[model samples]
Target chain A: MTGPRETLVGITDVVKHFAGGGNVLKREKRKVHAVNGVTLAIRQGESFCLVGESGCGKSTLARTVIGLNAPTAGTITYRGQRIDDLTPKAMAPYRRRMQMVFQNPYASLNPRMTVQTILEEPIRFHFPRLSRAEVKAKVEEVMLSVGNDPHWGSRYPHEFSGGQRQRISIARALMVDPEFVVADEPISALDVSIQAQVLNVMMDARDQRDLTYLFITHDLSVVEHFGSRVGVMYLGTVCELAETKALFANPRHPYTQILLAAIPRLDASGFRHTRLAGEVPTAMDLPSGCVFHPRCPHANARCKAEIPALKDQPDGTAIACHGIEEGRI
Target chain B: MALLDVSNLNVEFPTRHGTLHALRDVSFTLDKGERLGIVGESGAGKSLAAFAIINLLSKPGRISGGTITFEGQDLTAMDTDALRSIRGNRISMIFQDPMMTLNPVLTIGTQMVETLQAHRRISHAEAKRIAIAKLREVTIPSPEERFDSYPHELSGGMRQRVVIAIALLTDPSIIIADEPTTALDVTIQAEIMALMLDLCETHDVGLILITHDLGVVSEVTQRVNVMYAGRVIETGSTRDIIDAPKHPYTRGLIAALPQQNEAAQRLNQIPGSMPSLDGIPPGCAFNPRCPHVGERCRREIPALRALGEQQVACHSAEEVAALAGNGGSAS
Candidate 1:
């Protein structure tokens, strides 16, 4: 179900480009367009998923939104306040309100710190006036909420399994009582059974805390079950954005259709994927006009000459495809 | 006879503390041109089972028992040179990470030609010609141009295709692929899997696909083996196992998948993580996590018993079947 209707975070034409191949002597520089002109709105108390394959800039866009990386252009507004360009002191409060859960559980957690210390660090950092006993109580409470053993707080991250470590990661994110959590491929490293467990914990947390999540992942199946609104990204652009049900039922964009078809379903066998020609072009050397036109089956002369802006359809989906605009595909 | 037959396989790692049974009583058969899938979580010995078949298990790990027979010859009894001859010539293996499989230092052409010359008495030019043809077979664009390119020059999907080409170059009767598409993107995974399926069909090659993805297993393999904690807990047709699983673990695995239930609901997760090899439970390795665990399940192991088209190693197989039927109806 859709959560509260209020918009929590608004991203407008965010462009994040990284400098590449630059040296002091020659001064030859190249710009790698990681996130190019993307606009999205994340509603309160909803699981907004950014789905894309590798090199699609979904992770970079997420990092930029969470203030981990600065955007080269465009505005990111949180609760009607421009937070993207805020200074460190100005962004400190938002940092506590918005936490990030990284992809690799093995590398994300500090190997030297105990689970207790890791969980308490955020709470203590956010609330410096809180007593040590208060922080410990909060840590234990969050641990129990995530279905972890409270006593295991003394254990290091390396002592726990992948699933347990992920639970700890979730616990750490929930320590500050954040309103928004940007989780980038959190459970992609875990096993399938463990993935379900972690997902259940996240869903339970979402309902209990009334939190909004910006979930980023390459796994489409997880998005189908967990995401409320899905944003399909291709080559640093949001190709399509729609409600999960509508998108899965009637995908308007050709890239979205190809992605959904590529998912291997348990109900059927053999190849059901609509094969697309060509490969994803390098981000360093982007294609002209539409980035996806090289692999899209219905690309025409116009599609290769002009970029297609994401336009709203009657079905409540925002799609970026010249073919869809012209009813060619 | 089946192209590959493994019975009562037991792989162990000898440690200072004790012997760790990495794989216990793993048994399956891959017929000529048939595709078999082994599905399990990590530490379930699915990959180790595949490795042991080719005697490719790393040092400190050895097959303590069981027999792996390929074309009426016992692979377990073969020496190093004999195993080497059978490995790439008759039975090739594809690993999960193509980057790790392909030698980074060597060019694609050199690597392919090396594999060919290792198995066959062929000249460099002939081997190069065959390598290019195999590359073209895998649908690599401009095989001639890619021949001189290094592994680093290829994308993840292209590298996997190159690995597949290397596997097919020898025309091996059986190809054991362990999580072949796990490292690639979903679109690339679909294409690679389709290519593998097509190549296997055209060449009449037997395939033993070891993966944890139930969806991939259903689409690619005709028969499936559900493994848990180094044991094959269930064996049946892919259709039967997916549509009507008889083991509680099998049901739990299928139910744990996100597609099994409605959107945004709590997926039916199996309670605990899989036990390590040395710390497996005494009776049923999955008894601690199994919902339908009985007293007998904790005290004694259940042998694999035939139930129509399926074979399940669970004392409560009948109950599980009834529950699965009720689940299907309720859903």
Candidate 2:
């Protein structure tokens, strides 16, 4: 199963921390590490997924990748070039190479604007020299590329349903023809009957355009279905990374195993179930050593004190757990 | 004994054009300790079916015609006075969004105490004590501390837990959960569902869960009913509905799901969107979108045809049944 290096995007120990608010006169300053020591890579045209509960740094990592939030530490390299080193003004040219599709369609789209303006605005920013007629034509082309009817360009956001509006958002994201896209929970906000339709359209767009995706979601089942590579995040750190099949079939980390087991299998419903007893610990005060030790069923004294590094397993899967490192499980 | 029995229920809504028929001839019985899952796409009348049973349909929505018998009593004939007595005391409901069941301004403890006081005569201190115990029953951590917290302070998952705690406080004989976990992530969805199943079994309560998610239905429910535009197109045991669905619409939906283990260049999806309930197609509401639709299906609406323990409502039941058994792609 040896494949090409094919690394399109590389994240090297990225750390994004948000400063906490307090009295400046006589108070201590705290930092909430939204994403800590996160490192993963997406292949040229692979669907890389991140799965975890809320507040697990999944969205933080996605935001950091698309430049919505800058990394407080670490580096991000794109196509063998350092992206984190670029200034915001100098990063404008590189922005066309990467784009992001957000989760909420209502908040993402401006209610006052038509679909035409939403799609054209991106192209206007990237290629400002294009004439008015050319911009109109390009808007139609991009809209059609994402399966939105070109006629829909005139429709306002209020006229369309959730799925249709999301398509418009996709059109806006793909207008620049970016090689890499981060779709953050794109299908999560739609009705079940329409979720697959949106997923199919996005898959088609990805293949047609050779777009690499960083799909972030909390549902492991969707990751198993769509992601070529999967990473399990917990408490601001990546705990496991492997091919989708490898992660689901033979999950090495205890947190990932429980996450997978909790997704009720279609055939083995009710028969095989492990309801995690305790709630996810507060992310503000993370557990020491292994962040997942408090929830890990296989946790030991070693796991409680030492932060497990993401090391490659003999089977090629990357797991961050002391139990697996010590051959305890 | 059957805890809830809804017979030949029909609900209609007043609209600009005409009366919009929602649920039709929907008859379902739940024993004292039974788990039934009503599943269908949006606007498929699953939610209305639940609402009609408990007389919860408000305003433009009304149970125009129906006989709702709960615990051997006729609920349809009861006035607001009688209905209010049974609404939260004997039967409770949990909605998809936790905010629907909770008040934003009130503390969790106040809301719980108020709900308890609505049915039972108790002191405020006693009500607070019972509320704290109920919160603990739903597995809420630090109930003593959380009782003072507002709904906005809790996370989405925690808020849902509070909703469940309120729903279970009265120990209702029947609990109708309408897409309770749809707003949750899959991992949390499973945990909440497992908790509900245990609670039901422990309290000997009959459960009616309404959802558009088939995966959740097939997991948590014992029996399943597949609804179309506004009709129960198929009804049977959960095993029969998942392993051997009868109606064309049901089969199409099952096939449309992108299974985890299946390999395909493209995901299988139902070709067209759900037909608007404003005015459904000619005979079969699904005839326009149905792949196996025929002359009989387009001309005559079918009744529930019996097939062993399962019942199907389609003109081409035999053909659909045979196709379901043969395991051919439907959509």
Q: Tell me the native contact fraction for each prediction.
A: 0.80, 0.39
> Candidate 2 at A20: error in angstroms?
4.1
Stretches of model 2 off by over 4 angstroms after superposition: A20-28, A131-142, B104-107, B123-133, B140-158, B328-331
DockQ of the candidate models in sequence: 0.84, 0.44
lDDT of 2 by residue, B227-265 (tens): 987888899898887887778778777776766336324
Q: After superposing candidate 1, which stretches have Cα over 4 Å from the reference?
A: A1-4, A21-27, B329-331
Backbone clash pairs in model 2 (N, Cα, C under 3 Å; residues 3+ apart or in different chains), count: 0
Instruction: RMSD for all candidates, in order, please.
Output: 1.4, 2.7
Chain A TM-scores for all candidates read 0.97, 0.95
Locate the minimum summed-lDDT window of 10 residues in model 2 chain B: B258-267
